[model samples]
Target: MNDLERQSRILGVLTERPFASVRDLQIQVGVSGATIRRDIEKLHEAGRARKVYGGVAALDGLPPRAAALPFFENRDIAVAQKRDIARAAAAIVRDGSLIIVHGGSTCFQFGCEIAHRNVRVFTNSLPLAGYLGEHGTCQLTVGGGDLHREPGILYDTSGAGHTFYAAQFFVGALGISAEGLLEQHPLLVRFTAEMGRLANEIVVLVDSRKFTARPPTVTLPLSRIGRLITDSDLSDEHARMLEDEGVDYIIAPRGGEA
Candidate 1:
């Protein structure tokens, strides 16, 4: 690629991932070592990004926030596994059921799946609101709250105000720690807990990777979760925990796995 074209593309990658290594940029842009280095220098000169020991990162220095990537890019990252979990989750929706969707990429995918179904969706997620509002006939009610620009979610008093009703609520966690379903913010715990209590059922959509690590705050106890839908990579111990808590668990078959 020409120098201009290469520099522009490097800036774009830095904007998206924010923290990437030289190897990361090379892999992403499919350019040579020299090309990647030159592009990084150009970006640094433009004050768009800074180069670290092994890679380049956003000039802002913060990690790439969830909102930095639009809904579709987030969706495509774990395309097959998320779709499998989403499809399994979607099958549980009944006609005209009132569903509450928490804000996250996985849950947003579930929202996309259920949007075509005969259901009314209430969400605190900005992306889900946009997705369903555009493609579905279902009535969309977005919770009022302070917008969480990092994650594109609403998790404040305004978000919690709509908790008095809903047939089922779906949430995605940052990670599932041994402590329970975890998130990074205490406000998220309050909002998820309230919505979980209000809904008749609570479904936690987590891929297998979430089970191995934990985030900062507890979003729910296992007992509060009606079901856990994840990929087959879940360890037997974690699976046993869900079962012991009486949380119904569904493991979607991975690609080429039984």
Candidate 2:
């Protein structure tokens, strides 16, 4: 099998079982020990699974993810990189365009940058919605429902269909991988999936660090993503992998870029 096929099988094992040792993966994938080790490295680098001793572990370990850095506090985690990504993302917003935006600090930066545009934005982020409402030249609509405290996002868990539609969805990821985007919360998976249905295209905005780790659950898949705007620090290996998958990997200029 090809690398993609082998990697896909490894991911399936990681998903079904908590951990997969190299020997076990070798037996299951019908590959050699060296091949399994290389597959593990590829999975780890792609943010699908993490390496632990002689095996790969699912992102399901660790705490329940009931906690997250507060919204204001998260603003400084990677401020410049987020800004660069936002700037690149904002360029795609044309006048009178309609788009959907999800919640996160990176996405918040995107909201802040695009406040002067003529597009109408539909969002689930409380801060972003409020910012657009107060200062954005564009029209702003907030998704109404329960408020999630950690990130202060509004999601309708009622399982009701969304009423709005947009040409694009600008979303951020806590974790990203070749297989898909990941997030700790199941609520976010449902929300993003629902939001994705309303848009003709999905644009993911995440920094380079997010690529090193996978979150507990898959929120969206790589196939659904039209474009990914990230910082310049993303590795060439990942860039090539994304190219192979047909994802438009946009490298936003960071402070040190040429």
Candidate 3:
């Protein structure tokens, strides 16, 4: 990785947990110890982190500590359910469509489902980008920004080379209530907002678990959503509420083909 890529990974690593040694960062980032130290100094200068005994520490009020678990760790939960959701979300894409894919475990699975199609995917997730690169035939456009490595998500959309527009936006949220879509990662929220602006269709790829998984912040209001693709397990009460709000949604069956 180059210096910028290495520094981005350092920020990502520290976001999940504190780093006590330069060696730890070297192991996670696979760069020289000297490079790691220089990266730490860069982070310190940027106000993203601070130098301490042995290694770097996440700055206060940065939301790194409050961010959700790493994306791979999240993929282990509700595997079949997530796959079902992904397939349902993928089915909506037409051949040659340009789609914006939001970050999160479920959306990554959605990318897996659409990878072989003759479409293009614009995204801010490095993990999603890498997944598409390895398994997808679809054209991939990864936005430039700091890499949140654990989740492989890119943030700070200002780094993008040009503005983008999409036919569809396949997105996932941390929580959903009458209030709106919720998220723990502030940067991810900003990225999502940008995606929402660039796409005509904002399709939310949330599973049944999110009905009660409320986070402290609202990323997008329910009114802006075009549709919801969720598992069959979504409860009747919440489904009814969606109707009251006029938010269209689709339920992917538990054991059926995606």
Candidate 4:
């Protein structure tokens, strides 16, 4: 298997359990010990895993049930930009449309923008799901999986118990570049790809700041993104990059202007 695929498998194992021995990863990933070691080293460097004596462990060894403090920590960063982008994205959701909303602070803002809309939403965000369940009029379906609190995403590596499709998938990125939408966590990389497969089009919701933040792993290529929505702060150079990639984009106006 390739590096991305093998690393994803290793992370899957780590997510299902707390730690995975080098031998276990070798057997599961079907790679050599040296390959597993290298993968673990990379994961460790990316802050997604911790290297132990004989195995690697998920970051902090925290269970999936803990409260997602990180989500709240990020909820307030770039608040105005996220709200503007959310409003723009909300406009794209027609009444009675079905859409998949992936987990992230930015996506949570998008969820809030559509909380009372007459649409159907399938989401993996605990925060979004909770907000929608309490305040939304739209029909909602949540993914069945372990809730990873650090990233605030619910995902099942097995892809079990999920059988829905949507016209569009709305997601966020840790970083964006010529390589594609980047994420630091391997599970997120895998789950986002799975969600993309279930949608006819992919809509990216990212703040302009992410363009310069270079996360290490690419989740989707530029070709896969059908449209991108960002705040007005996006630079001309980055906008040209999207245009060159044939990606349709919208720059949301600030301060509630139309």
lDDT (0 to 1) per candidate: 0.74, 0.82, 0.80, 0.84
lDDT of 2 by residue, 77-176 (tens): 6678898899988888778988998899999999999899888889889999888888888888888899988777988778778776799999987777
Looking at model 1, which ten-residue stretch has the lowest summed lDDT? Answer: 63-72
Q: Which portions of model 4 show Cα errors greater than 4 Å?
A: 1-69
Q: Output the number of the lDDT-best candidate.
A: 4
Tens-digit per-residue lDDT, 1-258, candidate 3: 788898888888876674435767777888888888888898899887878534676776533232365776566556788888888877788998999888888998898998899998898878888888887888999887778787668776465534767899888988888988988877877777777888888999998767766678888899999999899888998899889988999998776563
lDDT of 2: 0.82
Candidate 3 yields a Cα-based lDDT of 0.80
Task: Give TM-scores for every candidate, taking all chains together and pairing residue i with residue i.
Answer: 0.70, 0.72, 0.72, 0.72
Error of 4 at 88 (Å): 0.2
Name model 1 segments beyond 4 Å from true.
Answer: 1-76, 156-160, 255-258
Model 3 segments more than 4 A misplaced: 1-67, 157-161
Q: lDDT by residue for model 1 over 1-258, one digit each (tens)?
A: 788887777778766655565665677788887888877777787787776434566766443332223343445445677777888888888998898898877898788888878788888888889878888888888888788776687766634355357888999886775567987666667778888878988999988756754456777877677888997768898888777667788987765254
Candidate 2's TM-score: 0.72
lDDT of 1 at 195: 83
Task: At residue 249, give the lDDT of candidate 3.
Answer: 96
Total clashing pairs for each candidate: 2, 0, 0, 0
Deviation from native of the Cα of residue 68 in model 3, angstroms: 1.4
* Residue 184 error, candidate 3, Å: 1.0
Model 3 per-residue lDDT at 138: 87
